[model samples]
Target: MRPKLQIACDHNDLAAALEDIKNVGDVVDIIEAGTILMLQEGRQVVECFRALYPEKIIVADTKCADAGTTVARNCATAGADYMTCICSATIPTMKAANAEIDEIQVELYGDWTYEQAQQWLDAGISQAIYHQSRDALLAGETWGEKDLTKVKKLVEMGFRVSVTGGLNTETLALFEGVDVYTFIAGRAITKAENPKQAAMDFQAEIKRIWG
Candidate 1:
C-alpha cells in the first residue's frame, strides 16, 4: 500500500502546536498529538485538533505501558482515531486499550523482536510501530538495514507498520523500496522554517516514490 504521513506536534504549548499544525495540516494524512503535547495539554488537545480537522486521522501518542483502558478511553473520548501502546504492556492491558479505541498500535522498540510481534499479531492486533531508538538517534543514528528487515517481516505477518524516529528527507530515501504503512515526521517538519511547504514536499516525495 502507499505510505501515509503523520506530522507530530511535539510542542508543549498548545498555541505553538496548533500553529505548527495550521502551517501543514492541510497537506498531511495524520496529526499526532505528540507525547509531550498530550502530557502538557491533556486529551483536550486531541479534542481541539479534532474540532479543527475532523477529516484527518488524529493520533494521541500516549505510549501507554499500563492503565491502557483509561488512556484509551480518554483518547477516544477526545477524538483520537488511534492510540499507541507499548508492546511490553500486559496482554490484558493491550486488549482493554484496543477495546476502547478504534485502533491500537503496539509500539515496538528497545530489544523488541519479531517473536514479540508474532505474539501481538496472534493476539488479534493488526498494527505496530517501528521506532528507531531515541538514544541511538541522539547519538546520530538513522534507519538502517535492520529497520528495513523488520518492516518487511512485520508486513509479511499481516501487520501494518509505521516507522518513526529522526526520519527526515535525506533518510526517507532509505525506505524507497519498502512497504511502510505510515511515515512519521516530527521535528523534520515542525521545525522547518516553512512547515506548509515542508509538508507539501513530504507528500510529494511519498507520491513520487510510491506512485
Candidate 2:
C-alpha cells in the first residue's frame, strides 16, 4: 500500500493552522493536531478540524505521559481517530489509553527498548511513531541508517510504524522498500510557499515509490 501522507499542523494558533489546511487538507490522508497547537488551543482544535474535515483521519498529538484513559476519552470525544502516548509510559497506562480510543500511537522518543516495544504489542498497541524530534532537527540532525534500522525492526516486530520529524519529498525516497504506514511532515508542508502543491508533490513521490 502507498504510505499515507500526514500534515502535522504544528502551529501556535488556530488561524495559521487553518490557513494551511484550507489549501492542503484535501490532499493529505491524515491531519495531525500537533502538540503545540493542542497545548495552545486545547481539544477544541481537534473538534474544529473534525468539523471542517469529517472524513480525514485526525490525530491528536497529545503525547500523553499519564492520565491515559482520560486523555484518550477526551480526544475520542473530540472526534480524533487516534491519540499519542509516550513510549515511556507504563504498559497499563498504554493499555488504558488503547481501551478508550480506536487507536493509540506509541511515540518512540527518548529511551525505549525493543523489549518494551514487544510489551506494547503484547498490550494490544500496534502503532509506533518514530520521531526525530524538533530539538534533534534544530541540532542539525537528519535521518540516517540508525533511524531506518529501528524503524525496520519495529516493522519486523509486527508494529505499524509512522515516521515524523523534518521529513520532505526528497527524504521519502530513502524508505523506498520499507513499509512505513505514514509519512508525517509538519513545517515542510505548512511552511511551504504553496502548501497544496507541496502536498501534491509529496503524494506524487509517495505513489512513485510505493506503487
Candidate 3:
C-alpha cells in the first residue's frame, strides 16, 4: 500500500504555518502540528488547522511526556484526529491517553524497547512512530538498513509504524521493506520555496515507489 504522507509544520508562527498549509494541504493526507508549533502557538494552532481543513487528518504532536490524559483530551476536544505521547511515558499514562482520544500515536524516541512495544501492542495501541535520532540526523546520516530492519520488525508485530525525522525523496527509497503507515516530512516540504510544488513532487515520488 502507498504510505500516507504527513506534512509537519514546525514553524513558530501560526500565520506562517497556515501559509504552508494553504499551499500543500490538499495533496497531503495528514498535517502534523509539530512540537515547536504546538509549543509556540499552543493547541490553538491545532484548532485553527482543524477549522480550516476539517477533512484533513490533523495530528497533535504534543510529544506528551507527562499529563498525557489532559493533553490528549485537550487536543481531541480541539479537533485533533490523532494525539501523540512519548514512549517514555508510563503505561498508565499511555492507557489514559488512549482511552480519551480516538487515535493515540506513541513515539519511539529511544525510549521504547522491543519488550515495551510488545506490551503496548498487548494493550491495544497499534499506531507507533519510529523516529530517527536527532544526533544521527545532525551527523548527516541517512536511513540505513538497520532502520529498515527495525521498522520491518515493528510491522511484523502488527504495529502501523510512522517513519519520521529528516525524511526526503532521496531517503524515501530506504523505507521499501517497512510498511510505513505515515511518512512525516518537516523542512523538506514546509521550508521549500514552492511548498505546493514540493508536496506534489513528494506525492508523485511516493506513488512512483509504492504504487
Candidate 4:
C-alpha cells in the first residue's frame, strides 16, 4: 500500500495551523494537532480542525504519560481519531488509553525494547511512531540505517509505523521501499512559502516512490 502524508500542526498558533491547513488540507491524509498546539490551545484545537475537515483523520499528539483513560477520552471526545502515548508509560496506561480511542500510537522517543513493544501489541495497540527527536535534530542528527533497521523490524512485528521529525522530500527517499503507514511533516510544509505546493511536492514524491 502507498504511504500517506500527514501534516504536523505543531506550532502554538491555531490560526497559523488553520492557514497552513486551508492551503494543504485537501492533499494531506492526516492532520495532527501537535503537542505544542494541544498544550497551547488545548483539545479545542483538535475540535477546531474537526469542525473544518469533518472527514479528515486527526491525531492528538497528547503523549499521555498518566491518567491514560481520561486523557484519551478527553481527546476522543474532542474529535481525535487517534491519540499518542509515550513508549515509557506502563502497559496498563497505554492499554487504558487504547480503550478509549480508535487507536493509540506508541511514540518511540527515548528507550524501549521489542519486549515492551510486544506488550503493547498484546494489549491491542497496533500503531507506533519512530521519531528523531527535535532536540536531536537541533543537535545535528539525521535518519539512517539504524532507524530503518528498527522501522523494518517494527513493521514485521505487526505495527503500522509512522516516521516523524525533520522529514522532507530528500529525507523521504531514504525509506523508499519501507512500509511507512504515514510520513509526518512539520515545518517542511507549514513553513513553506507555498504550503499547497509543498504538500503537492510531498505527494508527488510519495507517489513516485510508493507507486
- TM for every model, in the order presented, reads 0.96, 0.99, 0.95, 0.98
The CA lDDT of each predicted structure is 0.88, 0.94, 0.87, 0.94
Mind giving the per-residue lDDT tens digits that candidate 1 earns over 1-211?
Answer: 7899999888988999998898888889999998888889887899999999999999999999999899999999999999999878988888889999999999886777778777777777899999986788899887789779888889888998999999877777888888889999988898888888888888888888887
lDDT of 2 by residue, 89-136 (tens): 999899999999999999999899999999999999999999999899
lDDT-based ranking, best first?
2, 4, 1, 3
Candidate 2 at 161: error in angstroms?
0.6
Better of 1 and 3 by lDDT: 1
For model 4, the stretches where C-alpha displacement exceeds 4 angstroms are none
* Backbone N/Cα/C clashes per model: 0, 0, 0, 0
Alpha carbon deviation, residue 40, candidate 2 (Å): 0.4
Write the residue-wise lDDT of candidate 3 on 103-205 in tens digits. 8888988645889999888877899998886677898876778888889999999999999888888888877655789889888998888888888888888
Residue 200 displacement in candidate 2 (angstroms): 0.5
Rank list by TM-score: 2, 4, 1, 3
Off by over 4 Å in 1: none
Instruction: Report the Cα lDDT for residue 90, model 3.
Output: 81
Q: Which lDDT tens digits does candidate 4 get at residues 5-115?
A: 999998778997888889988999999999998899898899999999999999999999999999999999999999999998999999889989999999998889999
Candidate 1 whole-model C-alpha lDDT, 0 to 1:
0.88
Model 2: per-residue Cα lDDT at residue 162: 99
